[model samples]
Target: MAGLAALGAFAQAAPMVTSLGPVRAAVFPRLTGLGRPGHVALTFDDGPDPASTPRFLDALDEAGVRATFFLLGRMVQRAPALARRISDAGHEVALHGWGHRAHIALTPAQTLRDLRQGRDEVASATGRAPYWYRPPYGVATAATFSACRKLGLRPVLWSAWGRDWTATATPESVFHTVARDLRGGGTILLHDSDCTSKPESWRSTLGALPLLLEHCAEQGWKAGPLREHGIADADAEIGS
Candidate 1:
């Protein structure tokens, strides 16, 4: 059944443990970035890349849509103006770690340092502090949770993703891949940069944007940034 399949897909998407998928879906639904009914959160990661991010900005602007951009600290440093431009365009800017490495591979101290540096860079660049954090590769560890707590950040992961980082991805594929698991109140993950992906894969993501927006329109569900998605920190007592 369609409902059963969506449940299955959600379980696969929000794994608490890298090896255990269902537990997180069952236990931490809020952390999975499921927001208020009739709304879908649009989010992009690994960017502020000058090459492709601008294209996404242009597309989003033309569509009259806004999104959350989870920016890497190192990338922001390379293009602080572009990073600020994202915020200036009314997009929600969030942290995606200082580097592209997974938290599970780093020591506790390293993880904490990475988050602090990233949070600082994003705040400095955007002139607003980020309240949300999404670990690189969506992999979270004890240290990651600890760091988030210290930083006063709420950790969020996607309920659906485009898997558009592959070299072979096309616009239609990206749109459908996300559409498969997507529903109202779901957060959709995409990448605006190929800095950590197969080169130029972001072109596919850019092209997929209109289809996704139109699909949400047809479904009568509003699509916008996480801030507008109405995901409250009180939804769950994170790091408790």
Candidate 2:
């Protein structure tokens, strides 16, 4: 019976992982980046892997673009230099939590502690406090917002994702998935590391990025990190 209940809960929460629109509206609509026009924020999560991160960084450098990287604390502990390399490149370093576990699995207290630890790890590695966070799997439970509020982190959900966290994803499919819903002033989600997601998924994302940037260039769109997406410096204030 407990197993059945757990299954039911998961069944209910599964949809929010793919589409956070309705859930975000009730929790915090403004942070969702919906209906905003003219700039797109590129955000990468679950990374700092030596094998893959430098590839994406080189691609971004070649394209002359900077993105937001939501780093996992545990991974940073494993690869601090790679994390610093990300920050050193002028990309935004934000938190994706200490462990890349779903919010539904954590109590409010545990979530707060996770947020604090993740924030500290990034700051210690990058010498700057991360003011933004995107929860694992993009699902936010009741505890998430409270933890973010207390932690001084702003909760952000992507408006477009490449659906690249699968073994089958190709660069073409990833590009189309994001291009279908992408617009100016929206946040685009991709993975630079597969640390907490499907293995080798970062390859598809890396392959798709240049095409996406070129698409933006042709559209006269400005593509960059969150700071350029209009979340004010004041809104990005570091918290305790």
Candidate 3:
């Protein structure tokens, strides 16, 4: 069954290793300059929806690509089967809070509760806790980072974003944003589920995926998990 496969993959991914240590530093991907061979990480947020998630998965399958998904805990509870599909397909699943609330507005205790609930729901659905946490709308506070460290999740923010959460954003616009902003070691943010809108804002994302993947191939850019690059070390801060 799909659930068994997901469990097997989770074991292979070794989520327990991620939980073993406290995070010292969080490093996002460094941007690469033009004409240089680079790497990009593709990430999605706010989903596992029935309508849009399947389409996104089909596109990723067609492209032979993988991505990280920061899934909302409440949504996972609503669509546990779809969450299993995401895990079974070999994508990284991370936390995106319980209801997509802004972290800056919540007390540290409240933030911890939301993160704990989100991680628990995701792990329950997929059989492994996530190692990354992306705050809703890229809004983070000192409290958010503290909570992340306490929960054994690293705070992951994108180096570039497609702003695909907008209902009016066209596929072409999404493509342009990604292609124009891409750099080596950059994290590109896209959405597979849009809980913020009435019908959800994933149509543009679905339409933009193939073009983005093709462009990455043309540019010789590789894509992988966010943690694969490792956290930014003390040296990077000194150099920067």
TM agreement with the true structure for every prediction: 0.90, 0.87, 0.80
| Every candidate's lDDT | 0.85, 0.79, 0.71
The TM-score that candidate 3 achieves is 0.80
Could you tell me the lDDT of residue 142 within candidate 3?
52
* C-alpha root-mean-square deviation, candidate 1: 5.5
lDDT of 3: 0.71
Residue-pair clashes, model 2: 2
- Top-TM-score structure, candidate number: 1
The total of clashing pairs for model 3 equals 2
Given candidate 1, what's the lDDT at residue 180?
89
Least accurate stretch of 10 residues (summed lDDT) in model 1?
1-10
1-240: candidate 3 lDDT, tens digit per residue: 332233224324543312211121122222111112366778888887887899988888888888888899999999999998998999888889888877656778998999999999999999979987887866655566567667888666666667687767888898898777676666778888767753656888788888888888888887765655444531232121
Clashing pairs in 1: none
